[model samples]
Target: MNMKLFIFIVLISPLLASLSSFILKNKRFAEYISLLASSLDIIGAFIILYFVLNFKPIFLFNNAIAIDKFSAYLILLVSIVYFLSSIYSISYMRLAINNEKMTENEFFRYELFFNLFAFTMLIAPMINNMAVYLIDIELTTITSSFLVISEVTEKSIEAAWKYILVVSSGISLALLGTILFYLSGNIPGSANIVSSLDWTVLGLNAVYLNEGIVRIAFVLIVIGLGTKVGLAPMHTWVPDAYSEAPSPVSAMLSASLENVALYGIIRYFGIAGKSLGFGYPEVILITIGIFSIFIGVMGIIYQNSSKRLFAYSSIEHMGIITLGFGLGGIFGTFGALLQMLGHTLTKSTMYFGAGNFLHKFKTKNIKKIKGVFHIMPKTAFLFSIGSVALIGVPPSVIFISEFLIILQSLKDGYYLVAVILIGFLLAAFISLLTKSGSMVFGKADENFKAERGDFSPFSYVPMLLPLAASLILGFYIPNGLHNLLIGIVHIINFKIK
Candidate 1:
């Protein structure tokens, strides 16, 4: 019953918030309701995490709902973003309505889809069926694409369309891969015919599935879900969409949605690794992960738009997490899990800061927006610090996580992989810091007429909270978080054992 209550709070609150926001048509009311809903979700996520850590995996309603440590972790990550984005939204949307000329209807629509997007991500990890999970992901795309165009302009519309088309194509392939997995176990020649598509059943019976088919299905799953994870080649839509979306939506997209998408991929990785012996699946992830990192860094170096710079940074960070999981050691998996939390905190902070910049300068171009420190000292401090954390500097959780992945690569005798990874990290470190640094400390335009203050307490508070957490986690890994991540590593692979 307690489990049910937790589930109810986590899943129902956002939905209720979405409905109330749409029906009320009052912007302030919508903001508070969304904030209230996200607050509830944060409490529920922590409760769920506690239960998962203390007790057995929670399976409810005839195995339709499953909450393991892994699922609980993802839930916690999503809810954190939901809460922060909600707070930041109050300031962001207000500025949009005032400065950017956003209408009430548009704000209503934003609240509606924003909460709905949070709902989809929160529920995804708990769904037992892989097909159903993929479908839930599709629901996320629909809701978030709407969010991408929340401000409603030509570029936003184009980005939304591109996001839908590319990600939808990817979803279709994932669905196809799901179909193949079911067939792989059902083929007549098999000793045990797999009777279910539930992740619980498939994971336990992975070895029984036909290896030949599992191989192809996993690759298809990669390309399909990888598109959503913002892996290179399929990541073309990410920059445009994130650049065009409202900063809150961009944070959800890069920080929360990408993690949820990658969670699906890692599930398949576990099953595929169990069936195909970690080598094949690990290679695929490593190869793709490295290439994606290369693409992300290259994009970062050449990026002109502030939002787009961080969008590409999202791609790069996702690649690192992917590489960590692909390495598949205790250090690797643990690092990847920790990295998820760090990325959530820091990326949201960065995007929130970016949103503040957008409202202040009325442009996304990095060069055009100058002297943030002189204009908005509070935001500049947080944004500058957030960028350092984002780029994996020392005493940041990102730094620790990236270091662990590097350690794992060397431990596994992937010397060349380590070398290349270090090089890319260096390039990203220089490029991101230089780009973001200029905006913060460079000279302000002489004719600039915008106000010299931050937007509101709401704007900087959200950024301050996450940036602090990200830094703290770097200096200290709380015992509970450490235990939780270790549990997840055990869940993902035999390396921990």
Candidate 2:
């Protein structure tokens, strides 16, 4: 098949699925359509990745759309989460309708927004124009915020409201930054650049951009997109949105959407590094990265809700990734990219487990839920292992990434930064394990008899797949993935020698 054909399918499948789902809202087959659409997207993502590795970056629409290794990898990540979330939704939405009094209309709306949400994220990484990419990120916010309110309680509505308002404000700031980027290009003594917002154009002409304007624009980009990426200080809406959204939506938001937003920051990082030198952007990334780690660990230490606990963990992991990119050596950049994959796998697994717990135990409170090992043995086992992996346990992909990051920090002679990184990692490890252990093994309330097994194969299987992959990749990264990460590192153009 022509690669553009696949790209078209990748971009169009979800819209078709969303429309089909809305029309077929009364039918039980809507979920199957969703799964099929996501399956097609997965195939398309692989095709794009394969072509990018073997051939060249795929371009369409006169360069308006482009898919390189970095973009392909992101598409694959988003598709993977979308596929799993679709499968898990089969059981999750059913339970919501049967047990939680969720109406059919609410379920239908959930499917509609769910497919649209995935669509927005899928197209984001493929856009060649940075401005358009940011617009797509904003669209993701709007679509996923509706998913946040799928069940429409007061809290869910509030979460959705906060999500839209904060992220919109952040995006507005990013727009100002983007305009500055254009202005930098159009300034005096600079040749008029028609496509200033195109990443390709900006990248090629980065040296010509006004230095002071570039600095200010980079900061605005980070702050604006950082809000969407769930970086702290801009992260207040994240916990609420993740906690209140349906588990499948929460999984996508944390596992895939944040990465999509972060992709924008990293792109700008590349531009800024090219224009203003790596040191300036590196320092900015590292400072925010460390502070986010602190805030996330603190939140995990005191969290009472299971969903919110993982939300904080997401922030911590994002911090780690940001720090890795900031460190800017082969090890640091490679570790950060690897951490992105590890996080997508492990965090999604953990969220799936949390979703199951919510369905089976009817609560998100950490204290109220107990003896998951007895209530749902398989989910408990997987969730426990996922928690360990999430905290960088040995033989998990996270461990490798964290280790690589620490090695880079030490190698760079940033002794204090290394110590702080390790301290935060240890803190997160202890706090997360303690919280998950309690939920898995704590005594069940005397009157809390419910079920004695997992929700469905759909629920636990998705958790197991990612957990197993993380474990295997920890021991060995396949050649294809290794090369893909290397390609991305090259694209980021950071080297220490």
Candidate 3:
């Protein structure tokens, strides 16, 4: 009954489910196992949130696993998003079942990898040691690599290979940076290299650390992690991976793994600012942010593949989120957090809708499928709403967050950054609208066939709840949630209005 025990149980539940599933040998049961694991995880996250909001001790297992206000909020959000995405997977995977696209063994491989992926995302947020965290992230690559090729197609294999190569190379660089940092903190007199990997300790001693070494480590870490994060020039893997992976896995990659990478960047910035002054990380992030925005917007403008378009849009939003954090004030930081949360919900919803469309139309080409709303009204409606949110329209949380960031930048007199950001956002908006709007209202091809099947609650509920919550938050920020967010902003040392 102890809360700590429950927390540990939830943390371990996905791996437990995977083991049980290995014995069961039934892929059908694997979905159920994932659902159960996700449910318990969400419940545990809620419990943690409750304790944190009441200012109760949120540590578990040891001081090693503490949930401060910032992490508590993110933990709860990831749980909700992860659980919903898992449930949605049940429906999304039904296409694979019907089409016999995967052998039984391969299907079971999906079950195993899915659980491992979820488990890694769950634990990455909780780990205090940089070495341990890097290990956890490497595990993510190991788990997700199989999922990338769940289809067993030549293109899928190619995509998976590229994903593995790029991400592994990036992560290895990051690990080296982490080790160098550990070495930097080794006082010749003390045998405490491992102790330096603790984020709290590194943050405290950042001032005493060598600035040049810190800058080098930061560059290596950012470049390495930014590939996984889908930043510009380093984002080559994103479109191919997203296009080839099973829809459910694509959703998880965009929604969960991307967030995990962002979390790492946030943690690094926290330490870098305290140790080397804020301007260093800020300039790098801003430059990368601007370049990513340009790539995403330009890529989306002429994108033919629907999934690839969404992938590029995701890069743009990641850029926008980075832009907010790069500005580094209370409003900028809060807006960044809000955008991160909003994008997870909105982007996953978009992918779910896209999956349904892809299944019904049997194509990823946006031009091939038209008049979707007329044929599949619910899916079309959801897709339209998701598109609006992605474009940062009113009543979507992204709009609120983006507005705040722009305001903060202007007030700070970063006028050129503001101008470039706003321009890229508008360009992204136009690009998205062109594709989604055409698909919704245009005439269907004479050969187009509308596949009819019973839609599952798992399919709709998981995608809908997050989108609805995003809308509600944009319109009315509840007092309790607002207070919690304020606490989080302060913990991150950001000033909020």
Candidate 4:
């Protein structure tokens, strides 16, 4: 049980995948190698989770790397999406080669940046220094921007630029907030001064920090990280980027990358709450969370493109997660954390299904993508089931998570808040199902053209795996996961007080 060995396995696997893919430039080698790497990382992540559950938080490399239950949980989520996306990419990129006119160089580029993007996100939560963590997040932006333009279209280029410019600006603000956090502990004449930028140290000494600085810094952190989280007012980049990226990359972005960014924000939320009292930051998260959900549902209602429809759904889900955290109790916080897992499992299934539709119909427009059930029966069946789960239907983990959050709001006596939340949830539930149902059950055009069969098993297998996992979790939450989630709640709650 060498801790460092497992850490090395998790971090280095993706880096090696990125390097070998670019160096060798063989398509099949690149495809299978990426899959092999993700497989290894997934096993490593589970081991890390098991160790964290039974033992102590791990700090290695002179404390430059840290992994607590919270970090372990996030790592597991990222690895899950990484594994699924890699499998889906085999079918996805091959189709691009044969049908979408993708060059070998572009495919090579996709594999290179794809694994690197996962590597960056994998490292973000493990880093001890807040500033260094921000740098890693920025690296994800760079690698993912390349992935966004995998098809090299006008729309893809614009989406890449928009993704970079907007998210980079957000990261810059997060950096400033990190600097302010450092200064908060070193106020000019404080005898009990600590000048570390490591969040572990800052969080432990939050009570000694300057309250005024913590207040402003927390706001900046939320605004900054919220952009990456796809929160409203700062969520403009999300729709374009998610729509333009390949389905695998979109799953990584929506399912994994957003959770990584949010891990940073939640770290600060605890620190800021401890510094300035739980009340101040709770209001901020609650307010912004509500607004983001509003924006997300509106976008979903109006969305015509299949990918953009789900992009807005990401925003809505993130908002619910934030709102759950804002409510600040066991149910609220635990529900939010569970929602992260639920979202990751369900969303990847969705994007893979969407990828199938895109390949079959040769379009992103929902109107053009009708009668998926007619063309790709397996994909349409899974997509339809996934849509039901995505909308928080019963026998889905999302239903449990969202219901817990509502229960928290009611227990806290925020009646209006509960009502508003239920309203939006209802709106999103109806709107998304409508869009997906039309595509699944709608009539195919008289002159419908593409072949009437699903793509390779690679396309649909990934969908089935996660969909089944989500359904099982919904039916029965395992004792181990229940404890792990409770441990994560303690991780956040223990610091906030």
Candidate 5:
């Protein structure tokens, strides 16, 4: 079969299975179906990765459907995050099942939408048409809003409503921007007249594009996509949503969906920078990135809820990634991509660790829990390691990536910005270490007890796989993987060395 066809099937199968899960009479069967569908998608991702490694970029069903190193790499990422989340959900959802607060139907609803959310996150990267890309972003927002309030709690509902409003507004602007891009290309006698918004066309003809109109389009697209990336000011919905949602969904939001939004920004920025010079977009990205760093680290340092703290950390890391991108050179862009990969693995691991802690303690409050090492030593130990990784401590992938970013920052003569970046990161490390490390390693509080929990394959695999990947990547990135990433950088027109 054609690689793109196989990938397309892989992408669509989950949505079909999710729909079946919603209507199927046997809920147990639906669970199995969900698992099977995700596993198949995972298999397909591995297969596609193999092809991406050995073959040229695959285009299928016309040029509108294509898979390149850029898209293939992201597909692999979503597969890793979503597959693990799915496994984790099996164990996590069992908790909801036992609780009298949720209905049988409600659990199924949650599973259905969760699958849909994962599917859309995967599909967003492969979309070749701007309209299709906008549509995928809209689907992500809609599906995730329901997932946010799966528990139907008052706070979750508020978060969901806020999410719906903010993301909907953002997507609306993005759609308008997409339309404007088409108009910018359609101006009188200036360029090719294919009703096509193909990236190749846009990039090739970018110099001929109307500068003012293109700038307007880029601004709209960035703000629209920026809301999803949890850039500050537009980030109000993230903490509440992540804190209130089930931890796995929070992981997906922070690790997977946010990355998709960043990809969207990069796609547009590529055109702008190649045509209009990197200065304009770099300034905007830098401003937003710095602000997000300040907000994320400060918020995490003082936060009371463990999950909320992770949410803020996600924002901070995203800022770092954006900062790397804004630097706009080969090394800078490479660092940006590396930072993205590292953050995804680290953030998801952090959330999974947080999920384990939440399951044991049944609380989100940071102060109320302590002596987790005694209660659940394996989980506590893992959580502590994950937190260290999040802080970009040495020998973690994040540390290496952030080191590259900082080096690039200094090399680029952004001295003050580098100082601020270091300051925020140090503050964040101190805050999380003080807040989480003590809770895990210190003596038990009066209410603390090792709440014994069942160990399922589903729960352990998700947490461990990504963490192991982080550890391995941190200490030694495999030569093959390094080459693959270098190829991706070339494909995207970024240079690292």
Candidate 6:
């Protein structure tokens, strides 16, 4: 099939599914439709990736939409999460409707927005225009905020509100920065030289951009998009939204959406680095990266809610990714990209496990949830292993990514940075394992006697697939994936030959 046709199908499938689902509202079949659509999306994304690797980048709509190796990889990541979330939703939404008194209307709305949310994220990376990309990111924020309120409680409502308000403000700042990017190229005699906000155009003409203005604009872009990416000081909305949204939605948000938002920051990082040299962008990313890691670890240390704990972990992981990109060598950049894949797989597994706990025990409080080894042995086992993997234990993809990042710091002679990075990694490892250990093995309450089994196969199976993939990849990255990562590293112009 023509790659453009595949791209069209990939972009339209979710919208068609969303509309059909709302019209049908057949509780019995709605989930299957969603699953089918998401599956198609995954196939399309993979095809695009395959084409990009074997051929050249695909462009359509007068260069308005471009799918290169980087974008293809992101599309695949988003689709993977969307596919898993849809499968898990079959089990999760059913339980929510029956046990939590969720209205059929709310359930229908959830299905509608769920697919729309995925659609927005799917398209964000495909847009060649940076401005349109930000607009698409804003659309994701809007659609997902509705998903946050799918349960319709006061706290969920509050989370949705905060999410919209904060993310919108951040996007506005990013718009200002984008306009500055246009103006940086539109100086008195240069008006006709640069005519589009497409990343390709700006990147090609980066040398013509006013360096002074590009510097300030790049900073604004980071701060603005960083809010959407859940970077620190701009991350207040993430915990609330993640904790309140349904588990499937939380998986999408943390596992896929943040990476989509960070995709914007990275594109700009490439542009700004090309224009103003790597020093400025690298320092900015490294500083924010380290600070965000600190905040996330601190949050993990004190978190009481299971969902919020993982939400904070998302922030920590994002911080690590940001730092990796900032470190800017072969190891650092490759490690960051690898971390993105590892995080998508591992974090989704953990959140799905958390969903099982919530469904089984009917609580999110860490102290109130206990004896998972006795209550739901499969979930407990998978969740426990997932937690270990998440904290960068050996033979997990995360361990490889984190190790590569640390190696980069040492190679660059940043001893203090290396120490701090290791310290934070150790802190996260100890804190996460300690809390998970208490929950998984803590004494079962005398009155708490639920069945000693997992939720439907949907729940634990989704968890198992990602965990297994992470472990296998840790031992050996397949040649195709290795080359894909190398292609991306080249795209980002990191020098580490």
Steric clash pairs (candidate 2) = none
Which 10 consecutive positions of candidate 2 have the poorest summed lDDT? 187-196
lDDT of 1 by residue, 1-497 (tens): 37998899889999999999899788778999999999999999999999989888999999999999999999999999999999999999989988888998899999999999999999999999999999999999999999998988999999999999999999999999999999888998767998899988999999899999999999999999999999998999999999999999999999999999999999999999888899999999999999999999999999899999999999999999999999989988888888899999999999999999999999999999899999999999999999999888998999999999999999999999999999999999999999999999999999999868888899999999999999999999999999999989988995456
lDDT of 3: 0.81
Lowest summed lDDT over 10 consecutive residues: which window, candidate 3?
187-196
Cα lDDT tens digits, model 3, 109-166, are 7888888888888888787787788878888887888899877989999999999999
TM-scores of all models? 0.99, 0.98, 0.95, 0.99, 0.95, 0.99
Per-prediction tally of clashes: 0, 0, 1, 0, 1, 0
Per-residue CA lDDT of model 5 for 1-497, tens digit only, reads 47756786787889887888888846677777777888888788878877877877777667776677778778877877887787778778786667436677778888789889989988888778877888888899999999998888789999999998988898898888878888887788865543568776686777777778889998898888889899886899889888888888999999989888888888888788766887898888888899999999889978999899999998898899888888767666777787888888878877877887777777888887778887777777777888888788987888888888888889989999889999998899899899988778888777555445434666666777788889889889887667777776665553334
| Local lDDT at 349 for model 3 | 88
Ten residues in sequence with the least summed lDDT for candidate 1 = 488-497
* Sequence-dependent TM-score of model 2: 0.98
Residue-wise lDDT of candidate 6 within 126-149, one digit each (tens)?
Answer: 999999999999999999999999
C-alpha positional error of residue 313 in candidate 1 after TM-score superposition, expressed in Å? 0.2
lDDT of 4 by residue, 1-497 (tens): 78899999999999999999999999999999999999999999999999999988999988899899999999999999999999999999999899989999999999999999999999999999999999999999999999999999999999999999999999999889888988989989888898898888988898999998888889999999999999998999999999999999999999999999999999999888878888999999999999999999999999999999999999999999999999989999999999999999999999999988888888899877788888899999999999999989989999999999999999999999999999999999898998999999999887996678989999999999999999999999999999999998887877433
lDDT measured at residue 414 in model 6 versus the true structure, 0 to 100: 82
On the 0 to 100 scale, the lDDT of residue 459 in model 1 is 95
Which runs of model 1 end up more than 4 angstroms from their true locations?
Answer: none
- Distance from true position, residue 186, model 4, in Å? 0.6
Q: Is candidate 2 or candidate 3 better by TM-score?
A: 2
**Model 2 ranges with Cα > 4 A deviation:** 189-195, 494-497
Is candidate 3 or 6 superior in TM-score?
A: 6
Task: Give candidate 3 misplaced runs (Cα > 4 Å).
Answer: 187-195, 450-454, 494-497
Error of model 1, residue 333, in angstroms? 0.9
Q: lDDT of each prediction vs. the true structure?
A: 0.94, 0.92, 0.81, 0.94, 0.82, 0.93
